[model samples]
Target: MSPQPQAAVGAPLSRVDGRLKVTGKALYAAEHDVKGALHAVIVDASVGRGRIASIDTRAALAQPGVLKVIHHGNAPKLPYRDNPASNNPPDGRRLRVFQDDQVLFHGQPVAVVVATTLEAAQHGASLVKVEYDERKPSTDLEKAKADKPTTYARGNAEAGLRNAPVRMDLTYRTARNHHNAMELHATIARWDGNKLTVWDKTQWVVGTQTELSTVFGVPMDSVRVISPFVGGGFGSGLRCWPHVVVAALVARELKRPVKLVLNRRQQYFGTGFRPAYEYRLRLGSDRRGRLAAMVQELDAETSSYEKFTENVMYAGQMMYSMPNVSQAYRTVPLDVNTPIYMRGPGFATASYVIESAMDELAAKLGIDPIELRRRNEPSEDESTNLPFSTRRLRECYTTGAREFGWNQRRAKPRSRREGDWLIGMGMAAGVYDTARMPAQAHVRLDADGTAVVDAAASDMGPGTYTSQTQVAADALGLTMRTVAFRLGDSLFPPTPPHGGSMTMASVGSAVLDGCNRVRQQAIKLAVEDRESPLYGAEARDVIVRGGRLHLNSEPARGETYQRLLTRNKRSHLEALGSFAGPAAKERHSFYAYNATFAEVAVDAALGLVRIRRVLGVYDAGRIISPKLADSQAIGGMVGGIGHALLEHTVTDHRDGRIVNANLADYLVPVNADVPDLKAIYLDGEDPNADPLGVKGLAELVMIGVAPAIANAVFNATGRRVRELPITAEALL
Candidate 1:
């Protein structure tokens, strides 16, 4: 039998929601209208570490339209129940709003003022004075004491390092980064009787709902969260923050809807950011560049209250073939909020350290950077001894090298110069785990030949709405316009949090399952009906296209879904699509791989650097939406540029104040910073990864970007600086 032709799955379709966004019809969290909703502004702590000494609310009460001022002194005690299912980290207690007078970090919410208008709330909040006994804060990562190390070991690293022919020890530092999504963290909470409804800007509505319910000592079902649109969320919205609690608590107390929005400065304190890191790496390799052993020491900043941790050491365990490997990852509790996942999370940080060291090793060995990686590539996951589902990193390197004109690059440093600008090319390998969580989607086929797919997922500027719609359209044999994908609602079918680049592999698979089931049901009915043209045909032999069921061999003989359903007296068909996840214990290692190449030009005398070109080739299983994938790849490259040369969150260690809290001071890549950027996705699918054959793409796009740019800098000049945001001083 001939295979069915694909028209939507691999097509380069534009975003389905682009028009709504450009036309200003899309509504965000703060845009939701609630009758008589009060405005709220929170008063932040003046000190990073301190105890509240006194509070004054007399002047705040005199503000026009000021209704109430909430603080630890006057606010009611919340349940603050311990919830194991909440998004809180595994260790330490979650922050309880208005439950204590101790300030653990700078920018902690000390009080809130509620008023009829935003201006009144701002004035009242300013008038609510707070006095605290300030204490010196441990905000600097280098000086802070680290907790007991979490260690991992395999073979004898000490012996391997002593016996190796070549050895290198290097240290790298990465600055703290924040997820500055265009939309502020805002929430509008309204209560009626025992139920609460909230319109919030979050990546995980279910997680927020659960946290809010537990905080208020209410049933989980009593709280409903609606967020039809989000400006952007990298990973900041993965967990519920204290401000969300404040909004709900204030709304419940006032018996009126309360709207709370964090301004640009408050966002730094309100949510999480990518913690600054200091990574020390030591490598022992043979004469041919095969790694003999490695030892890694990692330290990262975390909130003093919560011991937040990410998968920082996972890449060291399996990225290359090494018999002797040892690692110690320690979290340094400091006067700061807990760090959360940014674009690539821990892997991006690790890749910069490891891959940059790889380039250094290549320079010492006088071998091509790509050649050095090939010499150490492992056939299977060395850590787990499991075969890979799909390991196409070799293809990525070769294809990327060819397309990027790597052959023209000079192996020697400072060899290519045009006037005062020195041009050099560098490449690095990247990999991210193929993670899939259990997810479900509810699909409905209406009588009018249209379909609706619902899931409690989020877009977060990754094109989830458009990509899911394409998946459903292809599965249900309908046009893109005929299928509607609904997400970001608690009432929809439950899905995993919309980060980790797993939405496509997880939620997409669920949509496919549900839509396929509905199509199969229709096929069964038509084959069994006597009047149908598809009658007596085997179910497997029939295929659907454009809502018409036809024999695979005879495309002209078929009936529209509406005609067949009308004859059968059916209004709609519904089905639940679900993916239960990999088996309890997986037999294979699954991951997406990429090879990133960067060409950079540096001004030798003035210490100025500029990117000339960047190309990323990825082995990310399937391309559900080619156009969207391109956008994701380019965006990742832009973020990488920021991480390498622009973005930094400055802190005043004496008082634990964020020095650069606003966008102007905390730099990001503007349009002028990005140059010629390109991406190429290797065409293929992993059957073991997911039903959709996708291993994940969003995070993979950014995994090795920083290291690639850094290596290019080294090739341009003879300098090997190990710090992030390669500044002019470092180059000089």
Candidate 2:
């Protein structure tokens, strides 16, 4: 088959759903209007860890519009079957909502009040009272006992450290962070006989469907999940939370639709968060900055019910060249909700520590930070001993340094000042492994010269709808307006989770294949039909442009798809395309690389740090949409600023309660906090990574942001605060 014209693939296009979003036409999970849907509010336990001793619901049940109060004593016992296919942790049992009196964490859902109106539900919930046998909670990461460690070793790390000329040991701490998206976590569930349907805020519809089916002990086909639009989900919606099941359970019990929207205060515990981490790194290097050995010990927070983990050790082994390396990762179970992936996840946390340590090492050796990193560049991935499919860190460094005026930076800290403020600039390199999974997409081309492509993919915020449309438009030889892309429906062709920076590589490739197949089917009909204009033309020499099939060499010798399909008396042509993911025996290690730079001004008297500018240069394969890519880059930088200087989920260890749960108390970067931000993409594609040649940009943009800012703070004030959220008190 001939290649389609490259018109829309790399074009800068606006989001297809932008107008709907701005006009409030895009319906989020809580906004869905289901007929006869009752409201439910969960009653939380006051103590962190304890068992419910007694409950009083007489006053709540007497309220007007109150329907029922369901607790462990009154709620029927659910099957609570094990579901390995979902995102639940594998180590321990999941929390069964309202199943027993045991309270595993503070704010555990002990009971729920159902009423015809949301206000009634809230009032009834507030009226109800519950007493608990309170117990002290193990909420402190430092004090809690850790589970067995997951260990990795490549060489004799301790011996290498002992023999190296220079050595350093550093410990860094990062606070927990909540997603805090604009829209709250919500679910609207309705049961029709044995079948269940839910409109949820989720990143993966099929995952939710499978989890709900398994939880209810029903067939997979008996559950349906629909999520057409999401306000934002920084990995919080990656799994089916307990509230989703609670909504479904209540709806089934009452034989009516149930709507549950977690209030802002409840959202803190209702959804997953980015776990707090304590990382200890030991490093040994030669005088010239060549790495010799490294050892890492990490402890992260997780719930007592289940153990959660992330890819925290990958960077320590492969980011730089090291002969000897060892790692031990442990999860400390606490009286908290399970943690999930957030933006960059493990890579973000690792990059902050590694990059900061590199800066410290450079300062110690009197060598330039960029030059020190160049000296440690690896020839291949030492972890797997495989050649890199595309490692462009050198190019990223050169590009970012030149673009951000790196040469003007002073090597001495606190040397450059502007009246009451000190200025500094810092840069860090980041890498994230490219991930792709099996996916399928369905495409249909009608006689009207239009195409529709769909998959069970989602767009939390990264413009998946527009980018997929671009892929389909070019492949099907249709205009952007003529190619319609739909998603977030379990009925569509299955796709992998929207996180992990894999949607474009996996789902877009499937859409491309499906569209290509449909376009080929149309061309075959035109070439073989005796009544067609290009009946004798070779199929290989034929090309499609704007719904017209023509010879590649002659533009005038073709007919529109409408003409060909109308003459053939065919309504439409459809195809299901799939990408089988990466090969079993991978030939190369694939990862996206970036160099992030930041400029900051610090006020010593006031102890305030202001971000002046941020620049990110990426070698993330081919960019499908430049405008949307910029949006992602800028948003990531803003988030990085928050992680470095402001965002922190403060918990009171006395009761395992989050004191700053509301947005009013929690600080995030607003319009005033964001500075001049820019993103530059290296021009090229990695054919080895995936069919689309995209190594995933969304997560890569966020990996090095926090580290860059943190390093800049040290350069400005000569103060190395090992902890995150570099507050004014720390500087003082």
Candidate 3:
């Protein structure tokens, strides 16, 4: 069902909304118009942790256009109900913003100032002074002690290490990183007769609606969220943060629609970020290169108010076939704001240590890195004891090695070089367990032979709108131009959060179901109409192609869907499709695999590190759109380059404040930094996983990228940098 030149699916076509985005006509959250709308700015707490003594708003109220400043003192004590719909907020109790004076962390929202204009709101917020009783904050993870270590042991690590010949005890440190999606987080809220409507930049509209309902003590139905276009999310937009709630609260207090856009500086404090992680790996292997045992100690940061868990212990448990393995994963609650899921999350942190440590062992044993991994490949997921739904990691490595010319890599460190630049190639394997969630979509078939698919699913730069349109076109037997896909409105069908690379699998499945139903209904109508060709043919034998339905055996004897609809006196047909999750997922394991190869240059004396090229081979299973899949791949590689050589979120431990909150100070990979990057998805699909037979590609592209770069650095300079960013200072 590929359209020529514009082959709807698997074609390298650009975004359908590229024109609107480039022309600046795409309205983001703050860009939406609200009648008689006021602007709101948040006032942040000055102390790390303590109680708010007083909030003075006299000067702010005296300012021109300043309507009101809402703080805990004057704010209403609303009912914060328990909502288990979201798998968040353990024990069903959550943070009640503006309902109490307890300041949990620095930069906590203390008050919100509303005014006629954005500038007036900013000026008013600057005038609102907040005094707090400060307390000593614990921002250091090393100094903190854990109450208990979640231990897992399959065999005695001590015994294995004693009997085995080779072992390496290495530790890695990954700095905190912010998602830094180009568009700042913003929300526009309006309340009319106890009903709330918001245009918010969110990854999950249903989650936001539920959270807002809980906070405002309103019914979920009374709230509707809209987010049509998003610049980028990575993972920052996955959760509904407190700032969104503040926008609604301010709008309700002012009794006028209010738009609250987080300033550039506010993005650092306003949104969630990937927490810093410290991982220590002890790998024990035989002299022949077979893994004997693995032990990992992982510590990550979280907020004091809530328990945030990232499955850091996942990779060590299932990546290899080691019988003896033990992992102690602990979360150190810090005084900083709560952290949210980021790209690769726990797996990214663990891979840095595990992969780097494996490279070190390869160096010590004088074995090829690829050969070593192949020697230890697991037949099944060790942790779950279930067969993989689709595990082509081995194939990924084989194809990647051939395509990347991995065999050309030399064994001896510093063996490959040209003049002063030391060029070395390295590769690492990465894993991510594929996930599925329930989703719903509504598809409409028009009498004019055009179709429209509507869902609350968002296209946060991953081409959800375009990709889903392709799926609908193939399923509905229609041309790409005739089908229009619309998203980002709560009035549409419900959808899950767009993070974790699950949108394609989740939403695509829903689209398939909806379109299948619509097509079946059309087929039924055509057979009964007597106007359609081969009218008496069974519905099962009826096949549609190029917007026409007819018998598969006799293509010439067919009629256009438009003709059938018009002759049947039907104006349009609509179908609602919902893909419920599998009840027995344990029957088979599902995971996405990738093999990343990197070429790096390291200066012998200056220790300057530069990535020469990167190629990622993915076993994500049945790429829905090759063009869009490649886009996801390239975007991920760029993010990986940042994680390897640039991106770092620096915090001032003294005050528990982020130091370099702006992009100018905190660096990311630019065009000049990433020279040559490419991605290739293996041509295959697994029906056992889902109806779409598509595993996610977004996160897998970034999984082993840092390790590949790190391994390349080691090969070039003979220095194994377990810590991330493999920066010039670390090399020097």
For all candidates in order, the CA lDDT equals: 0.92, 0.93, 0.85
> What lDDT tens digits, residue by residue, belong to model 2 across residues 1-732?
567799998889999999999999999998988999999999987889989999999999999999999999888888888887775354788889888999998888999999999999999999999988899999999999999999999999999999999999999999999889988989999999999999999999999999999889999899999999988998999989999999999999999999999999998888889999999999999999999999999999999998999988899989999999999999999999888989998999999999999999999999999999999999999999999999999999999999999999999998899999999898898989899999999999999999899899998899999999999999999999998999999999999999999999999999988998998899899999998878989999899999999999888999999999999999999999999999999999999999999999999798899999999999999999999999999989999999999999999999989999999999999999999999999999999988889999999998899999988988899988889989989988
Question: How many backbone clashes can be found in candidate 1?
Answer: 0
What pairs collide in candidate 3?
3-7
Q: Quote the positional error of residue 605 for candidate 3 in Å.
A: 2.6
User: TM-scores of all models?
Assistant: 0.99, 0.99, 0.97
Backbone clash tally for model 2? 0
TM-score of 1: 0.99
Model 1 lDDT tens row, 503-565: 998999999999989999998999999999989988888888988889988888889899899
Error of 3 at 540 (Å): 1.9
* Candidate ranking (TM-score, best to worst): 2, 1, 3
The regions of model 1 sitting more than 4 angstroms off are 1-4
Candidate 2, residue 89: how far the Cα is off, in Å: 3.7
Alpha carbon lDDT of residue 340, candidate 1? 86
Candidate 3, residues 1-732: lDDT per residue as tens digits? 222122466666677787889999999988998889999899988777889998889999999999999989988887877767774553213567799999887788999999998899999999998888888777776776543566777778767866778888888899888888899999999999899999999988888888889888998899999999988888888777888988888888778899989988788878888888888888899997899988788888777776677767888999988888888887887787878888887888888788888888888999999999999999988888989888888899999999999888988888878777788888999988787789999999999999999989887898888899898988898887889999998888898888787888889999989998998899888887665675787888787787898777777877888888888888998899888866564688888989999999988778888888899999898888888888888988889889988998877777777789899999998888886888888888979888988888888889999999999988988877777767888877
